[model samples]
Target: MTPKLVAGIEPPYYTAVFTSVRPDAPEGYAETSVRMQEIVREVPGFLGYESARTPGGIGITVAYFRDLEALDKWRLDTEHQAAKRYGREHWYDSYSVHIGKVERSYGFERE
Candidate 1:
């Protein structure tokens, strides 16, 4: 697990966490992941994303650059916008988005 109180990172980053209801989504999981990956690549501040499915729903967290404008652009991205509509029309039952800026962060690393 990542630290709750992180500190000391050179460049700032954006932390976005998204959680959504699966509601009979097993068949489309692969398709959804592929679409998301494609969209992320198109976004200006494209970074990385992690996702997992549980009995109740799917959880996705994407870490990207420190640009609110870029983030907003992604929100309104053509493909993504269409996907959002499709999600509301079909894919997801419900979802929530949480966005925050990472001012300073630190974590103990041991491998």
Candidate 2:
């Protein structure tokens, strides 16, 4: 299945592609994730995201933003920092973050 796209965003935006493997006992993971989602939405220039996970526990979330500065702000936010630390210490077995510029995009829908 395809990951759902964040709707209504124009092209030429930035995307942060986050992929991770979940740890066995992820205490507080869900709460932190929900809080981070809420926090990012309140950040200026924040767009939206698409997320999915495989049955084996690999997950991916692609978050879009208006520009590098907005992405940077989100990255540097204090709450985000805490979340990252928590992930490193408790939740993620391995992960990767890829930031890229989206110059153009197109899609189709079948009803």
Candidate 3:
């Protein structure tokens, strides 16, 4: 696929979306969650991740990256596979991942 090129930055960036539903998880669940996130850090195109837990049954995560190929590598990674298995059996009740290209982003944080 020909990557979409933006004027300000590079092309073919990666975006990962992970959603889940964990109704009644025990305490320390979030603590363990941190460990899971660390695994993603080792993935090739793991740019960044954002997450939230809602009232009813909603868990969402988005991970950004510099290239889709890197994202694919992450998806097929061995440790990632194990984490997925663990999520299926224990960590998460349900989850999903949506990936996309980041065409543009702006920052103006005070330095």
CA-lDDT, candidates in order: 0.69, 0.89, 0.69
| Model 3 lDDT per residue over 9-85, tens place | 35457678888887656555666667767876786656666666788779887777778777877788786677678
Clashing pairs in 1: 6-105, 7-105, 7-106
TM-score of each: 0.74, 0.91, 0.67
> What digit string (tens of lDDT, one per residue) describes model 2 on residues 15-48?
9999999954378888888999999999898999
Ranking by TM-score: 2, 1, 3
User: 57, model 2: CA deviation in Å?
Assistant: 1.1
lDDT of 1 by residue, 16-68 (tens): 77878867555665687688778777778756555566776665655564578
Winning model by TM-score: 2
Model 3 segments beyond 4 Å from truth? 1-12, 24-32, 107-111
- Sorted on lDDT, highest at the top, how do the candidates line up? 2, 3, 1
Candidate 3 structure lDDT: 0.69
RMSD of 3: 7.5
